[model samples]
Target: MIREPDGSIKIYVRDNRHPQVIERQLRNLDVRADVTFLPPGKDCREPRGTYLPDNPALLTSEPPAEGKDDYWRLHPEQIKPGQTFVYTMWYEEHGDNRMFTARYRVATGPVAPCEVVPGGPVMKEGPEGGIGD
Candidate 1:
């Protein structure tokens, strides 16, 4: 239940308190799914990743699961040096959960980030240098 790219991670369980449950499930069941966006109605504006929709006073309304539209768009110019991403998720009994934040990595590539440039080929890691000479 950890998502990469733009969307957040989602964790659903019958009953589990500790956040480690996710790790256990992933390891035990071999749950392999690359997260790319907040699974509708799971994303929130809270500091930590968790959901308690029943208590309005406790939390705010979250958007429902969505597709790529929920993705956080990034452009080449927006990327900078020294950027390390760390996202955390928590799950409680009888409740839905989501990732605290989307993790991102500053991979060494063509020296330009082009997540929102629409068209145009961007640099990428190849077997040896770039394609051809």
Candidate 2:
């Protein structure tokens, strides 16, 4: 997690391998979160719009019935290989509050590295709190 100078935090997941899919389980994340996506080998990061059709079906606290585990499902809508998935979170406390943390583990699909950077805010479209964020 990257602590910003303005007291915000930036969490990112980077895919550096062949084309693959990534899923993140959000057990906490009680505060406001802005999810952004960055293209492969590019610095431009844009907000990933809502995952419709499956938006309501996706679980943010518990896994799906067919899910192997019980955790919220968060993934990039169109993240290809070498792309970066970033989720920036902001809290009212503005300090070291560990309550808004998300955990990442090895799944059966692919393996990617996570990084933290300086960022803030995000754009939104469609419904509110899309993807259960």
Q: Output the number of the TM-score-best candidate.
A: 2
- Per-residue lDDT tens digits for candidate 2, residues 44-64, read 222233222323322234433
Off by over 4 Å in 2: 1-71, 76-78, 93-133
lDDT of 1: 0.29
Local distance difference test, per candidate? 0.29, 0.29
Worst 10 residues of 1 by lDDT: 51-60
Clash-forming residue pairs, model 2: none
* TM-score, candidate number 2: 0.20
lDDT string, candidate 1, 26-56, tens digits: 3343332112233212432322222213222
